[model samples]
Target: MRRIVPVLALGAGLSLALSGCFVNPLESITENLVEEGVEELIEGQTGVDIDVNGSGISLPDSWPSELPVPSEGTLQYSASIGETFSAQYEVSGRGTFDDLVSKLEAAGFENTGEIEYGGLTSTALETERWQVSIVYIDGEDSTPAALQYSIVDKDAP
Candidate 1:
């Protein structure tokens, strides 16, 4: 019984110590970028507008690139339940949803599956602590456009 008590206590301590390392995914990304000076990159790349909806963060004008001209897409929003902030990306093009999925997968996003949003089809992907959604649409000039959003949990795995 004496030996067992020490073993249990040691296990408990280790578990508590490890739990402290787990951070929210979104927070982790923000922290990492801030540390690496990527926050400036984001600000310089585009302006962002944040809208908090249930289970999602909406950005109406997440990307404003005139030359690239986002094909004909809207903002992509992603967030975890408890995350204070979320991540987003924009894609533009007119193609099958699979094409967007492939693009994200190639970009290191793990393909999860497909979902439907307001009658439009979308592909979903998830990393250890982040989630992404992608969709494509027809541009104003009939060009192809795609939109994507990557939601990173502050406490990511």
Candidate 2:
């Protein structure tokens, strides 16, 4: 019994020491590495970059070249549940949405259409690989406008 107790104590101590060493790598792979892999996978599948700043949603490549990012612009992972990723840039200047639309068109995107309701306008632009939406409240005193872009991999599990 004396020998068994010493062996068990040694085993337990060794396990505790070893566990600490292994946990960090496992955790690193699970959180940071996994998120990076997911970002790469999403970008590969959708051809849009994912920048999850942990704010709201991820932005696409070459966003807001001409348009200005609002002083309080938010870009992070999707806000709504079940949305893997999406991003929006808010602008407080006049004709912000129109400028964004023109930028998209110049980038080879076709103006798919526009939707209006409740004094708001949403213009959609599409390409072979992605879709972008510019939304703004019509006639609002603030002239607050937003550009929302998203890309989802249907094959992602």
Candidate 3:
């Protein structure tokens, strides 16, 4: 009878302890810390600030407010250096490269150049204050689609 109570207590304690594992499962605190440390190290080594959170990418505070950034893609990385800002994203169902292109044009960016070679496309654009580049990979069997965007201040010396 006394042994039964100990077993029941052990089981209850184990159930409570194991519940935490299920909630986070494979979540890695070390991975997050390493990623953050790498980002900070890169920022310190270079004059550029960078963000690599895959959940949602945002523009750096140093970026010019006149530029518009798309929110529909999984932001792999973002960088800001002086008057230049750039980002790379994995194209998800939420948004496509074409949608980003249209959004830029609608925001008053003029197309400066277009290039296509071997399923890759690059578009250069410019607004009154910024020069921008939009590059993307068309769908291929072996490679997932991705997009890149960059903007530089036209007047930055």
Q: Which candidate leads the pack in lDDT?
A: 3
Candidate 2 vs 3: which has more TM-score: 3
Q: Can you write out model 2's per-residue Cα lDDT over 1-157, one digit (the tens) per residue?
A: 6334433433343243223222476774555554555555545544434543343454444443433333444442332112223455655543666665676787787888988787677877767655556666544565445555443333334
Query: Higher-lDDT candidate among 1 and 3?
Result: 3
Q: Candidate 2 — what's its lDDT?
A: 0.50
lDDT of each prediction vs. the true structure?
0.42, 0.50, 0.68
lDDT value, residue 149 of candidate 1? 42
lDDT of 3 by residue, 10-113 (tens): 33432432233223534556545555665666566555677654445577888777666665766766777667777777775325767777878998989899
Query: What does the lDDT read for residue 134 in candidate 3?
Result: 85
What shift in Å separates residue 27 of candidate 3 from its native position after superposition? 9.6
- The deviation in Å at residue 83 for candidate 3 is 0.9
Candidate with the greatest TM-score versus the true structure: 3
RMSD of each: 17.2, 17.5, 17.0
Global CA lDDT of candidate 1, please? Answer: 0.42
TM-score of each: 0.33, 0.41, 0.70
Model 3, CA-based lDDT: 0.68
RMSD of 1: 17.2
Tell me which of candidates 1 and 2 scores higher on TM-score. 2
